[model samples]
Target chain A: MSLDQNDIAKLARLARIRIEPESVADLQQRLGDILNMVDTMQAVDTTGVDPMANPYDAFQRLRADEVTETDQREKFQAIAPSTEDGLYLVPKVID
Target chain B: MPSYTVAEILQKLESRECSSEEITQSYLDAIAKQDGTINSYITVTAEQALAQARAADELRAKGDAPALCGLPIAHKDIFCTDGIRTSCASKMLDNFIAPYNATVVEKLAAAGVVTLGKTNLDEFAMGSSNETSFYGPVRNPWDINCVPGGSSGGSAAAVAAGLAPIATGTDTGGSIRQPAALCGLTGLKPSYGRVSRYGMIAFASSLDQGGPIARTAEDAAIMMQAMAGFDLRDSTSMDVPVPDYRAALNNDIKGKKIGVPKEYFSAGLHPDIAAAVQTALAEYQKLGAELVEISLPHTELAVPCYYVIAPAEASTNLSRYDGVRYGYRCEDPQDLDDLYTRTREEGFGEEVKRRIMVGTYALSAGFYDAYYRKAQQIRRLIRNDFVEAFKQVDFIAGPTAPNPAFALGEKANDPVTMYLEDIYTISVNLAGLPAISLPAGFSNGKPVSLQLIGRDFDEAGLLAAAHQYQQISDWHRQIAPHAV
Candidate 1:
C-alpha cells in the first residue's frame, strides 16, 4: 500500500500536475503514509455491502429540455486566460 | 455595537435605533482595526457593503425591508460572489472574480444582508487546519499563537472576534464545526441537498454543504432560514419546503431521548474536552432530556473513508483549472501539457497537491476497488450506524473535536495527526446528516464544543437542542481578549 517516487511521478502525470524531482521523494513518503492509513479499510469485511455513491440515494432530478439561462458567452469568455475572436486560445495541438 | 448578535441588530434596525449604514460602518471599522492580526478576511467589500446597507435603509424607509435586510455577514471565500474574488484560498483562483453569485450568496444578498467580505479557507477546502490557506494561516481569536481549526477558520475566527456577527461556512468533513468549536461559535453543517451548492467551489460533490456560523444557535437558525431553499441550478438540491428554523427554536425537548456514542469518549479524546462534553450532556438532562449510551461501531473507519471520497471528487472537480481557463496560468507555457502541469505545480499548495496525488492513485485503474469502492462500502456501514442509532434516540451527542485549539505549528509536520483533528465531526458528513457544534465550556482557557447530530434534513432539531443549551449556558457569549 506504499507509494514510491516513481508512483508519485506517474500519478502526477495522470493528474496533470508537475512534480519537481526533489519534491517527488517528499510526496512519495507523504503519499505512502496516507495510503498506509487508508489501508486500514481492508480490515472491515465488505463482502456483500453495496457501494454508496451519494449519501442520499436520490436520483438526479430531471427537467424538460429547454433553454433556461440566456446566452452569456461574452460574459463568461471575459474571464478566459486567452480569448480572441470569441474563441479560447490554447497552444497548437496539430503540426 | 460590533459585539451585538444578529438578533439584537435586527431589533435595533427595526426600531430605527440604528441604521444599517451605521451598523455596517462599525463592522468595517472593526475589521480595519482588528483583522491585521486575525487575517480572517481575504477581501473586505467595504464599498459594496455600505452600498447594500444604504439600499437596506431605503427599503426600510419604504416599509419593505426583509427579515435579514441590512445585517452584515462574512462569506467563506468558497462561495462565489458576482464581480468579487472567490479564491477558495487557492492561488490558482486568486485573480479570478466570479461572474455570478452562489445560490447562498444571491439568496442572502436578496434578503438585504450586507456582505462584509470573503473569508479565507484551506486551499480548495482541503485541510483540517487554516495553515493550508494560501493567504496564510488564520490565528485563533482565543489565542493568537494557536491554529483556528479549518477550512472555515476565517469565518469562525471573524465571528468569534465580533468582526462580523454571522458568517457563512461550508463543511465537507468538519470544515465548519471544527473551526466553530475552536473559535467558540455555533456552527451548523446542514444535510446534503439542504442548501444549494451551485457556484460554491466543489471539493466533493456528494459531501459539501454550506451552513451558518454565529455566536448563538438562534443566530445560526436565522441565517440558515435565509440561506436554505431549492434551486434548479443545483441538481442535488432538494425540493422540500424549507422549514421555519426560528419558530422551531422554542420547541420543548422534555423527555426527548439523546444518544451519547460511547465510542466518542475514546482514549484519544483530550480529558478536558471530554469533561466539557460530559457537563453539557448533563445539562441537557437537567432540561429533562434523557441520555442513552449508544455505539457507532464503524466510527474509526470515517477518516479513511472520507479521505478517499473527498479527494477523489476534488481531483475530478479541479481538473477544469488548466491554464487555458481563467485562473493562475504558468508563465510561458511550452505546450498544453506544460501549461497544465506547470500551472498546477506553481498554483496549488502542498496539502492540495498531496491530496490530488492520493486521489489520483485511489481512482486510477487496478486500485479503484481496493480504495475508492471499498471506502464507499465502508461509508454505507458508517451511515447505517447512524440510521440504527436514530431509530432509538432523537439526537446523538459528542465532543465536536478531540481537543481544543493547538499551537499553530504543533501538528503541521504530520499530515495524519492533523487529519485526526476532524475525527469526531467527519462521520456526520459521512452519514449526510445535519449537525451543529455548541460552544460548551473552556479547557485551559480555550473553548471546547459539544456536537448534536440530527436525522437527515433535521436542522431544526439540531438548532433547537443547541439553542436550548445556550439558553442555560454563557460559553457561546465569551469573547477573546483582543476582541474586547
Candidate 2:
C-alpha cells in the first residue's frame, strides 16, 4: 500500500494537479502515511454488504424533462476568467 | 444588545423595541472593532448590510416583519452569495464572485436575515482545523494561540466573538460542531437532505449538509426553521414537510433514552473531555432522562471510511474547477494540460492537494474495488451500527472532539493526527443523521462540547435535548471576555 514518488506523480497527473519536483518526496511520505492508515479497512469483512452512497437511502428524484431554468448565460459568464461571444476561452485544443 | 440570541432579537425587532438598522449597526460595529484578532470573516458587506437593515426597518414600519427580519448573520464562504466573492477560503476561488445565490442564502435572504458577509472556512472545507484555510488559520477567541476547530471555524468564531448573532455553517465531517465545540457555541448539522445544497460549493456531496452555528440550541432551532426545506433545484433535497423547529425546542425529553457509545471514551480521548461529557450526561439524567450504555462497534472505522469516500467525491467535484472557466488560472500555459495542472497546483493549499492526490489514487483503475468500493461497504457497517444502537435508545452521546482547541501548529504537520479530530463526529455524517454539539463545559480553560446524534430527520429531538440542558446550564451564555 506504500506509495513511491513515481506513484505520487502518476496520481497528481491523474488528478490534474501539478506537483513541484522538490515537493514530490514530501507528498509521497504524507500520502503513504494516509494510505497506511486506511489500509486497516482491508481487515473488515464486508461480505454481502451493499455499497451505500447516500445516507438517507432515498432514490434520486427526477424532474420533468422540460427546461426549468431561464437563460442566464450572460450572468454566469460574467465571472469567467476569459470569454468571447458567450464562449469560454481556453488554450487551443486543435493543432 | 450585541449579546441577544436570535429568538430575543426577533421579538425585539417585531415589537419595534430595537430597529433592524440599530441592531445591524451594532453587529457591524462589533465586527469592525474585534475581527482583526479573530480573522473570522473573509468579507464584511457592511454597506449592503446597512442597506438591507434600512429596508427591514421599512418593512417593520409596514407591520410585515419576517421572523429573521434585520438579524445580521455570516454565511460560510462555501455558500455562494450573489454578486459577492465566494472564496470557500481557497485561493482557487479567491477572485470568483458568485453570479447566483445558493439556495440557503436565497432562503435566508427571503426570510429577511441581513448578510453581514462571508466567513472563512478550511479551504474548500477540507481540514478539521481552520489551519487549512488559504487565508491563514482563524485564531480561537478563547485562547488566541489555540486553533479554532474548523472547516467552519470562521462561522463559529464569528458567532462566539459576537461578530454576528448567528451564522450559517455546513458539516461534512464535523465542520460545524467541532468549531462550535472549540469556540464554546452551539452547532447543529441537520439530517442529510434536510437543507438544500444548491450552489453550496460541493466538497463531499453526499456527506455535506448546511446547518446553523449559533449561541444556543434555541437560536440554532430558530435559524434551522428558516434554512431547512425541500428545493426543486437540488435533486437530493428531501420532500419531507419542514417542521416548526422553534416549537420543538420545548418538547420534553423526560424518560427519553440516551445512548452512551462505549468506544467513544477510548484511550485517545482527553480525560478532561470525557469527564465533562460524563457530567453533561448526568445532568440529562437529572432532567428525568435515562442513560443507556450502547456500543457502536464500527465507530473506530468512521475516520478511515470517511477519508476514502469524501476525498473520492471531492476529487470529482473539484475537477470542475479546471482553469479555463471561472477561478484562478495559471498564466502563460504551453497547453491545456499545463493550464489545468499548474493552475490547481498553484491554486490549492497543501491539504487540498493531498486529498486530491489520495482520491485520485484510490479511484484509479486497479484500486477502485479495494479502496473506493471497500470504503463504501464499510460506510454501510458504520451506519448499521447507529441504526442498531438507536433501536434501543433515542439518541447517542459523545464528546464533540477528543480534546479542546489545540495550540496552532500542534498537529499541523501530521495529517493523520489532524484527521483524528473528527473521529467522534464523522460517524454521524456517515449515517446521514442529525447531530448537535452544545457547550457542555470547559477543559484546560478552553471549551469542550457534548455531541448528541439522533435518527434521520430527528433534529427536533437533538435540539430539544440540547435546549433542555442549556436551560439548566449557563455555559452557552459565557462569551469570550476578549471579544467584548
Candidate 3:
C-alpha cells in the first residue's frame, strides 16, 4: 500500500501536479500513511454490495436542450489569465 | 447587539426596536475590532453591507420586507459572490473575483439578508483544522491558541465571536458541524440535494452541502428557511417541498426514540466529550425522549470510505482549475503539461495537493476497484447501518467530534489523525441524512457538541430536537471569552 518515488511521480503526472524533487519523499510518506488508513476498508467483505455513488440513488435530471444562458463571454473572459477572440489562451499544443 | 443571537436580532428588526443599519454597523465595528486576532473573515464588505442595510431599512419603512430582511450574515468563501473575491481560502482563487453569486448567496440576498463578507476556510475545504487555510488559521474564540475546527472555521468563528449573526457554510464531510461543535454554535448539514449547489465551489460534488451556522437551533432554523430549496440550475438539487423549519422548532419530542450508537462511544473518543454527550442524552430522556442503544456496525469504515470517495470526486472537480479559463496560473509555461502541473503545484496548498494526488491514485486505472469501487460498496454498508438504526429509532445521537478543539498545530503534521475528527459526522453525509450539532457542554473550558442525525430530508424534526435541548440548556448561550 505504500507509494514509492516512482508511484508518486506517476500520480503527480496523472494528476497534472508537479512535485518538487525534495517534497517527493515527504509526499510518499504522507500519502503512504493515508493509503494505509484507507486500506482498512479491505478487511470488510463487501461481496455483492451494490456501489452507492449518490446518496439518494437519484439519477441525473434531464433538461430540455435550450440555450438558457445569456452570452457572458466578455464578462467571463475578463478574468481569464489570457484570452484572445473570446477563447481561452493556453500553451500551444500544435507543432 | 453583539450578545444577541440571530433570532433575538430578528425580533428587534421586526419590532423596529433598532434599525438594520445600526445592527449592521455594530457587527462591522465588532469585526473591525476583534477579527484581527480571530482571523475569521477573508474579506469584509463594509461599504456594500451598509448599502444593503440602508436598502433593507427603506424596504422595511415601506412595510414590505422579506422574512430574514436586513440581517447581516457572512458567507464561507467557497460560495461564489458576484463581483466579490471568493477565495475558498486558497491562493489558486485568491485573485479570482466571482462573476456570479452562488445560489445560496443569491437566495439569501433575495430574502433581504445583507452580506457581511466572505469568511476564510481550509484550502478548497480540504482540512479538519483551519490551519490549512492560506489566509492563516482561524483561532478558536474560546482560546486564542486553539483552532476553530474547519473547513467552516471562519464561518463558525465569525458567528461564535459575534462578528456576524449567522453565516453560511458547506459540509463535504464534517466541515460545518465540526467547526460548529468546536466553536460552541449550532450548525446544520441538511440532507443532500436539499440546498442548491449552483455556483458553490465543488470540493466533492456528491458530499458537498451548504447549511447554516448560528448560535442556536432557532437561529439556524431561520437561516435554513431562507436557504433550503430546489434550484433548477443545479442538477442534484432536490424537488421536494421545503418545510417551515421555524414552525416545527417547538414540537414536543414525547416518546421520540433517539438511538445512541454504541460504536460512537469507542476508545478513541475523549472522556470529557463522552461525559458531555451522556449528560445531554440524559437531558433528552428527561424531556420524555426514549434512548435506545443502537449499533452502526460499519461506522469504523466511514472515515476510510469518505477519504477515498471525497478525494476522488475532489480530484475530478478541481481539474477545471487549469491555467486556461480562470484562477491562478504559473508565470511561464513552455508547454501545456508545464502550465497545468506548475499552476496546480504552485497554486494549491500542501493538503489540497495531497488530496488531489490521493484521489487521482484512487481513481487510477489499476487501483480503481481496490480503492474507489471498494470504498463505494462500503459506503453502501455504512449508509445501510444508519438506515437500519433509523428504523429502530427516530434519530441517532452521538458526540459531534471525538474531542474538543485542539491547539492550532497539534494535528497539522498528522493527516490521518486530522481525518478522524469527522468520524461521527461523516457517516451522516455519506448517508445523505440531515444532522445538527448542538452545543452540549464544555470540556476543559473548550466546547463539546451533541450531534443528532435524522432520516433523509427530515431537517424540521432534527432542528426541533436540537431546539428543544437548547431550551433546557445554556451551553449554546455561553459566548467565547474573546467575544465576551
Model 2 over residues B204-260: C-alpha lDDT tens digits?
Answer: 999999999999999999999899999988889988888888888899999999999
Model no. 2, DockQ: 0.84
Q: Where is model 3 more than 4 Å wrong at Cα?
A: none
CAPRI level of candidate 2? high
Candidate achieving higher DockQ, 1 or 3: 3
Q: Which lDDT tens digits does candidate 1 get at residues B5-101?
A: 9999999999999999999999999999999999999999999999999999999999999889899999999999999988999999999989999
lDDT of candidate 1 over A1-95, digit per residue (tens): 77767787789999999988888878878888888998899999999999998887878989999988899888888888899988988888777
Between candidates 2 and 3, the one scoring higher on lDDT is: 3
- State the weakest 10-residue window (summed lDDT) of model 1 chain B: B475-484
Error of 1 at B382 (Å): 0.4
TM-score, chain B, each candidate? 0.99, 0.99, 0.99
* lDDT (Cα, tens digit) per residue for candidate 3, span B447-470: 999999999999999999999999
**Each predicted complex: what DockQ?**
0.86, 0.84, 0.89
Deviation from native of the Cα of residue B25 in model 1, angstroms: 0.5
Alpha-carbon lDDT of model 1: 0.92
The order by descending lDDT is 3, 1, 2
Per-prediction TM-score, chain A only? 0.94, 0.94, 0.95
